[model samples]
Target: MRVLVVGGEATIGRHVSAELRRRGHVVVTAGRSSGDVRVDVRHRDSVADMYREIGGVDAVVAPAAHGTTDRLQTLSRDELLQNMQGKLLGQVDLVLLGQHHAAAGASFTLTSGIFADEPWPGVTGGAMINAALHAFVRSAALELPRGMRVNVVSPTMVGDSVDSFSSTFPGMRPVPMDALVTGYLSVIEGERTGEVVRAYG
Candidate 1:
């Protein structure tokens, strides 16, 4: 299978990309500023451009999102919108536009986070966006045409980035990137749709 992994240069995305390659699947990586192709998911045009460049693929995995990390009190309206524009609408836009570019029976795996189910300080924006993605995946799955599938991966703090996030996610046992990648692979390779595969330790 040929797979396009957005944010493929990042920690989790890198793991997914590597594992897919090891399984003999052709992989293409895309990001805003890195990877085999560039895509700013916040904009529909950019997402469309990315699909045009890649042509069509059997799977599209997104392990990246852009959002603000400020407390609710300190978050401005613009900051809240920024998070929605990127993480929530960005991934949603990819699915909407990608339907036209993906092959029959194609699957889309999107990334959410533990914050959607568990709260932490200064992550209101992220939590909301994550939860929204989960809901989007569930509802979108029911409407997708031509055997398309949609799912979301909600992973806890990743072990590789524990140093940077441990303080924020106190008491949270960070899950290994390799383990989280497995959940993504299930969505990519399995027949499940509208599922929220949790990778929590």
Candidate 2:
């Protein structure tokens, strides 16, 4: 499969990209600054441009974080909108515009987080956006044409990410990196749609 991974420069996206390539899939990593193509998923035009540049692919994986980490009360309106545009609407734009570029029955795998189900300080906005991604997958999957499918991977902080977010998840165990990667593989390589594939350690 020709897979496109937006934000494949670091963290989860990096791991996912490596695994896919190791499995013999043609993986293309894209971001605002680096990768086989340049794309900023927050903007529809950029996403459109990315698809145009790369032509069509069989799958698109977005294992990236683009949300603010501030308490809801303290978050300004601008911050909130930016988070929405960066996280929720950004991935949505991928699916919306990608339908025209991807091959038939193509799959879209998006990244959300454990916050959607479990709360943590200063993560209210992220939680909301994560939950919204789940909702979007459920509804969009039903309406997608040409057998296209959409799913979200809501994973707990894993491995290297533990140090950065451990404060928020007091007793939360960092999910194994392999488990999170597996969740994405199942969604992109398997037949499931509208599913929230979760990985927790």
Candidate 3:
């Protein structure tokens, strides 16, 4: 399988990329940083260029997005729109544009966080964007063509990055990065679509 993983330099993205490669699939990573493909999902032209460069892929997983932790009252219009543009509309457009670029039966897995339903204060942007993303995935699943499958991975705050925001999640399960990798694999390899695989409690 030729897999294109967006945001491949991030901690979870790196782990998922490595896991896919270990399974003997050829992995091509893309991000704003070092990658075979470079595209800021926030820009439509950049994303289109990325697909052109990669030509066709068996699967495309976007584990990259921009989200912020700010109280709703404190968030500026810029901050709120930034989250909506990148986390919600960015992936939505990616699917719309990428449909023609992916091979028949190709899979697309998007990233969301557990904050969608398990909300926390100061994370209103993340929570709203996450919920919208899941809804987008469910709708896209029904409309996508050519046997293409679309799903979202709503992972909890990962253990590796727990130090950054561990306090935000008091009793929530902090999933190991490895366990999240399995969820991505399930989306890619399984017969299911139109699903949000919650990789944590």
Candidate 4:
């Protein structure tokens, strides 16, 4: 399968891209500063341009998004909006615009995180965005055209980032990057849609 992986420079994204390659799938990585193609999901024009450049693909995987980690009290309205624009709508718009550019049976695998269910202090913005993405996938799956499929992968803190987030996620067991990548693989390869494939350890 020919795959386009957005945010493919990140740790999880890299793992997903490599694993797909190992399985004999052709993978194209796209991101703002890295990857084979440049795309800033926060901008609709950039996303549209990306799809135009790539034409058609079997799958589009987004393994990264941005959200604020500041305390609720310190977060301004603009910050919250930025978080929503960058993580929630940014990813949703990708699917909305890429649908026409995707192949007949193309699939979209979006990324959320364990925060949707397992909330932590200073991450309310991320939690809300993750929850919203889950909801979007559930509803969008029912209305997608041409047999297109959409799913979200909600993973716990990955082992690769545990050192940095360990204090924030104290006592939480981090899932290995490999294990989390499997959640994405399942959505890319499986027929099930509107599902939240959880990779919580």
Candidate 5:
């Protein structure tokens, strides 16, 4: 199978890409940096260009996004939009535009986080975007044509990176990146759609 993994430069995206490649699938990993192609999820044109370059693939996985980490009061409207633009809306656009370029029955797996259901002070933007993305996947699943599938993977902070987000993720259990990749593989290979698979819970 051919897979296009967006934001494959670091963290979960990197692991997901490597795992897919290890499984003997043809994987094209893309990020803002050098790759087979460049994709800024914030822009629809960039997503389109990536598909154009890769031609059609069997699946698209997005494991990267950006968002503000400030409290709601400190978050400017622009900061909120920045999160929505890159993480929420951009991934949505990826699916909407991807339908045109993906092979029939193609699968799309998006990334969300524990914030969708869990609460953390100073993480209002992430919470909002994560919840919205799950909603988008549910609705998109029903309307997608030609057996295409859409799903969201909501993972908790990685156990390996707990130190970097210690302040924000106080007391939260970090799931390993390898564990989270299981959710991605589930979405890609299973016949499921419209589901938000939580890696921790």
Candidate 6:
């Protein structure tokens, strides 16, 4: 499979991309500042341009999502919009625009996190968008054409990055990187659509 992984250089993205490549898949990585191609999902034009540059692929995996983490009350209007554009609308547009560029039977694997269900403080915007993605996948899968499939991977905080996020997700058990990647593999290789492939408890 020719897989295009956006944000393939990030902590989690690298692991997912590497595992896919190790499995004998053709992985083409893209990101804001890194990867084989440059794409900032926050903008629709960038995503559209990215599809044109790549032409076609069997799969598009996004392990990247950008958003603000401030408290809902303290988060300014600009910050709220930034969060929506980055995490919510960005991936939403990625799938919406990518549908036209996808090959027959192509698949899209989007990234959401555990916050959707278990919201910690200061994750209002991210949590809302993550939950919205679940509904988006459930509905979009029914309408996408040419046998295209879409699923969102909702992963837990990775053990590798536990130190960085332990404060935000206090007392929670961080999932191992190996186990988290299975969420992507399930949707990428299995016959599942409109599903939220949870990567941890």
Q: Tell me, by TM-score, which candidate is best.
A: 4
Candidate 3 worst ten-residue window by lDDT:
164-173
| lDDT tens per residue, model 1, 1-201 | 999999999888888999999999999999989999999988889999999999989999998664557977788878888778878888998899999999999999998888899988888889988999999999999999999999999998888989997877689898887889889999899999999999998
Window of ten residues with lowest summed lDDT in model 6:
64-73
lDDT of each: 0.90, 0.89, 0.86, 0.89, 0.87, 0.87
TM-score of each: 0.96, 0.96, 0.95, 0.97, 0.96, 0.96
Task: Write one digit per residue (lDDT tens) for candidate 4, span 111-197.
Answer: 888899986888888898899999999999998889999999998889999889899778899998888888889889989899999
lDDT of each residue in 1-201, candidate 6, tens digit only: 899888889987898899999999999989889899999888999999999999899998888675557876677778777878878888998899999998889998988888899968888878888999999999999999999999999887888988887887788888888888888888987779999988874
lDDT string for model 5 (1-201, tens) is: 899888876788888889898889898888888567888878888888888888999999998765668777678888888778889888998899999999999999998888889988888889989999999999999999999999999988887688898677688888987888888998888899999999983
Residue lDDT tens for model 2, 60-171: 9999865768976778877878889978898999999999999999999998988899888888888988999999999999999999999999888787778887776678
Alpha-carbon deviation at 197 in model 2, angstroms:
0.6
Write down the lDDT that model 1 would get. Answer: 0.90
lDDT of each residue in 11-47, candidate 3, tens digit only: 8888888888999999999988688878888888888
RMSD of 2: 1.2
Location of the lowest summed lDDT over 10 successive residues in candidate 1: 64-73
What residue pairs clash in candidate 4, if any at all? Answer: none
CA RMSD for every model? 1.1, 1.2, 1.3, 1.0, 1.2, 1.2
Per-prediction tally of clashes = 0, 0, 0, 0, 0, 0
lDDT of 6: 0.87
TM-score quality measure for candidate 5: 0.96
> lDDT score, residue 197, model 4?
95
